[model samples]
Target chain A: MSDARTALYDDHLAFGARMVPFGGFEMPVSYAGILREHDAVRHRAGLFDLSHMAQYHLEGPGVGHWADALTVNDVATMKPGQARYNIFTNDAGGCHDDVLFYRLDENRWLLVVNAGNAAKMWPYLVARADGRRDVKITSGHGSRALVAVQGPLATEIVAQLVDADITVMKYYTCVETHVCGVPAIVARTGYTGEDGFEIFVDSDAASELWRNLFERGSRFGLEPAGLGARDVLRLEAGMPLYGHELDESISPVAGGQRWAVKTRKAAFRGRDAIVAELEADTHDRIAGIVLDGRVPARDGYAVYVGDERVGTVRSGSMAPSVENKNIATVLVTKAASVLGGSLDVEIRGTRHRATVVALPFYKRPTP
Target chain B: MAQPAGLLYSKEHEWLKVEGDTATVGITDYAQNSLGDIVFVELPRIGAALKQHANIGVVESVKAVSDLFTPAGGEVVEVNAALEADPALVNRDAFGDGWLYKIKIDASSMPDALLGPDDYEKLVATS
Candidate 1:
C-alpha cells in the first residue's frame, strides 16, 4: 500500500526536508542536516512534525476505569491536566505499546500511541470497548496534527504564539488553549528530554501553526528537525523508542522500565506476568553502552564479553551530546548489563571495546 | 547537476583527478549529498594495491553506510588524514579537502568505463 501523508507534507517539502517512509506515512527524516538539526534542539530550539503518531480520544465516566485496567500505570488516579506515561501489555508480560495519557478533564482523556502501533492498537481498543455504552473511543490519526518545539529556548518560542501563560505550566501538564489564533492542546511534554511543548491542533490549522512558529522562532535559532535527529536526541536522553526498546516480545521490565510497572494495583492486564518477572529478576534487561572508538554501533549488532555472545544492540547512534562519542542500548544478559562492565560490540566482524554505562548518556543542565 | 570539469567519474559516484602518474580520488557531490551528515570514513590503508572499481573503503552517515569504490586501479600512495579527525569534510567539500586518497597510476591506465565530466553529469541527471 502507498504511504499516507501528514498535513505538514507540503510545508516539509518547502523546507527542503528529506522525506522517508515511516510507520506507513511519508515523513521527513532530516531537513538542513541531521547533526545540524540535532545541535539546534540541544542549544537553541528545533521544531518537529509528529503528526504520524496516533491520538485516541476517550470520554465518559468509564474512561479512567477502562484505561486503568488496560495499562500498567494508574490512569484513575491522574488529576485533570496531568500527563502520565503508560504501557499496555499482553498476557505474557510483553508490551503492546508504550503510550502517554493526557488527562484533559475529569471525564476526557487523550491516549497517544506510537505511529507504528496504531493499526494494532485501534483494533485492540475497539474489541475491548464493545458493548460498553458509557465509554467511547475515537480515532484522530489523520484529522489531528502534532507539532513539537524542543530545546532550551523552546519556552520563549512557544510563549509568543500561545494565548495562555504557558510559562507557569509545569512539566507533564496539559492545557486547552488558543495558539496561532486556533484551538490547540498545549502540553509541557516532549520526547527529546529537553524543555519543550507539544501542540495538538486540527489538521487545517497545522500549516499556519508551523509557519507562524517557524517565522517567529527563527530569531531564536529555531530550525526544522526530522526523525533522524529526533532519534538521536531521544536516544541520548535515554527515552525508549517503541520498536527498538519496547516491542510485543519485550516486557517492560526487560526494557528498563521497571519503575512504570505498578504491580501492586488491584488488577490490570499482565499484572501476574509482570509480577512474576519482577520476582524472578533473571530476565535480560536493557542497558547503556558507550563505544570506545568512533565507529558507530548499529541496531542488531552483536555484543560480546570475550568469547561469549551476550546480546544485540537494540538502538545505536553517534551521540553528539555524550562527549561526541558513540552510544547504544543493548538488550543483554543480566550479568553483562552491570554498570562499568567491559563489553565489545562486533561491527563488520571487528570487536570494538565498550563500557556498560548508566542510562541517559546525556542530561540537560538544570537552570 | 553538472559535474566538475577535468575529472573522470565512475558509475559508483567517485571522481578521479589525474595528475601525471598520481591520481586523487574522492566521492562526487551527488554521492556526498546522498549520504548526508557523514560521521565516519574508513579509507583503505596506504601502499595497498587495488583493482579498478574495487571496493576500497566505507563512508558512514548518521543513518546509513555506503561502500567507497575506486574508479581506477593503482598502488595506494596516500590517504587523506584530515578525515580521521573530521569526516564531515566530505559533506562540506566532497571534491576538495574531502578527497579520500591518492593512487600512483598513469592516466592512460584508467579503465575505459570511466566517464568524462559531460558523461558523468548525464549519469547524475538520470540517477
Candidate 2:
C-alpha cells in the first residue's frame, strides 16, 4: 500500500525534518534531533503535525445516546465542548483503539482515532450503526489537518494566534475559534505531560497556520517536534501508545486504563468481559521498570523474575528529561508488578536489574 | 563525511587506526551522524577477544539501538571508560575522543577487505 502524506509534508522538508514511514504515512520522525525537540517541548513549546490521525463526525438526532453506547467512557454525561479520552473495545474486552470524544453538541460529536486503526474503526462503526436511523458518520481523515502546540508556554504562544480567551478554557475542553483568520477548533489537550493546545483546521490552510505559529512562536522557543520526540514525551508522561500499551490482545484493565472504561451506565461493548476480568484478577498488568544499566530495554524484550519469563516490554526509552535513567513499561504478571519489587530485563542476552516504580516517570508540576 | 587519511574503514562504518599491531577503533563521522544523539554505549571487555566484522558492543540512541562491529580480529586492550558516563561524545567527536577501544591485532588474522579513505568515501556516498 502507498503511504499517505500530511498537508505539512513540504513544511517538514523545508524545516529539515528527517522523514520515516509510520502508520502507513510518511511522517517526520525528528527535525532538530529528538533530544533537542523533546527538551524544547518540556521547557518551552513545540509544534507537531498530527494530521495523520483519523477524525470522524457523528451527527444526528440522539447521536449523544448512540455515542454513549459505542465507547467505554460515559459520553452522555459530558457537556458540550468537553472532551474525554476513551477506548473502543471489542466484545472480547480487547481494545481496538483508544480514542478521544469531543462532544460538539447534543446532536453532534467528533471521534479522533489512531491513524492505523482508522480504516478498521470506520467499518466497525458503520456495522454498529447498521440498524440505527438517527445517526450519520463521515470521515474527515485527509480533509482536515491538526497542529498541536505543546509545552509550558503553549497557551501563551497559542493565545497570540487566536482571538479567543483561552485562559478560561479548562483542560480537555475545546472551543470553536478563528486562528490566523481561518476557522478552527482549538482544544486544551495534549499527549505530552505539559499543558498545550491542539488546533484543527482545513488541509488547505494548514501550511499557512503552521508557518504563522512558527513565525510568531519563535520568540517563545517553539520548535517543530516530530514523532520521535512525540514518542519520548508521551512515554515520559506515561501515556499509552496504541500498538505498544494497547492492542487486540491486551484488555483495558491489563493496560492500566480502567479509569476510562465505565461498566455501570446501561451497557456498552466489552462491558461484560471487562467486568469479568476485573472480578477474576487473572490478567497481566502494566508496570514501570527502571533499569540499573545504561543500555535501554527495547520493546519486545523479555522480562523475567528469576529464571521464569514473566512478560514483555511494551515501550522503553532513555528518557531525555530524566538524567541517566533507562525506563520501560512492561506487561508483567500481577505478582511481579508490585512497587519496589525487583525484576530483570534481558537486553541482547544480558540480564539487567530493574525496579518496578510508579506508572508515570515524569509529571508536570501544577501552579 | 570526514574519513581521515591512513585509517582503515569497514563497510559497517567503523574506522581502524593501526600502529604496530595495536589498532584503535571508532565509528566514523557518517555513522554517528546517521545515529543521532547516542545516549549509551556498551563497550567490549578489556581482555575479550573479537573477530573481524563481529558484533563486539552495543550503541544506543534515543530512537533506536544498534550493534557495534569490530573491523578487525584482535584481543581487546583498552576500552574508553569515559563514554560510560557521557555517550554523546560519540556524537560530538566521533573520530577523536570518541574512539571506542584499542585492540591488540593478531598478525596473521588481519582482514583483507578493509577500505581506504577514498574508497570508504565512495562507498558512503553511494549508500
lDDT of 2 by residue, B87-120 (tens): 9999999889999999999777786889999999
> How would you encode candidate 2's per-residue C-alpha lDDT over A214-306 as one tens digit per residue?
988889999999999999999888899999999988988899898888778678878888899999998898999889988888999999999
Residue pairs in candidate 1 whose N, alpha carbon or C atoms collide under 3 angstroms: none
Error of 2 at A288 (Å): 1.1
Q: Which regions of candidate 1 deviate over 4 angstroms? A: B106-109
Model 1 chain A lowest lDDT segment of ten: A257-266
State every prediction's TM-score relative to the real structure. 0.97, 0.97
Per-prediction count of colliding residue pairs?
0, 0
The residue-level lDDT of candidate 2 at A322 comes to 66
| lDDT by residue (tens digit), candidate 1, B1-127 | 6678989888999999989888999999999998899999999899998888788889999899799887888899999999999999999999899999999984555656888999888888888
Q: Evaluate all candidate structures by whole-model CA lDDT and list the values in order.
A: 0.93, 0.90
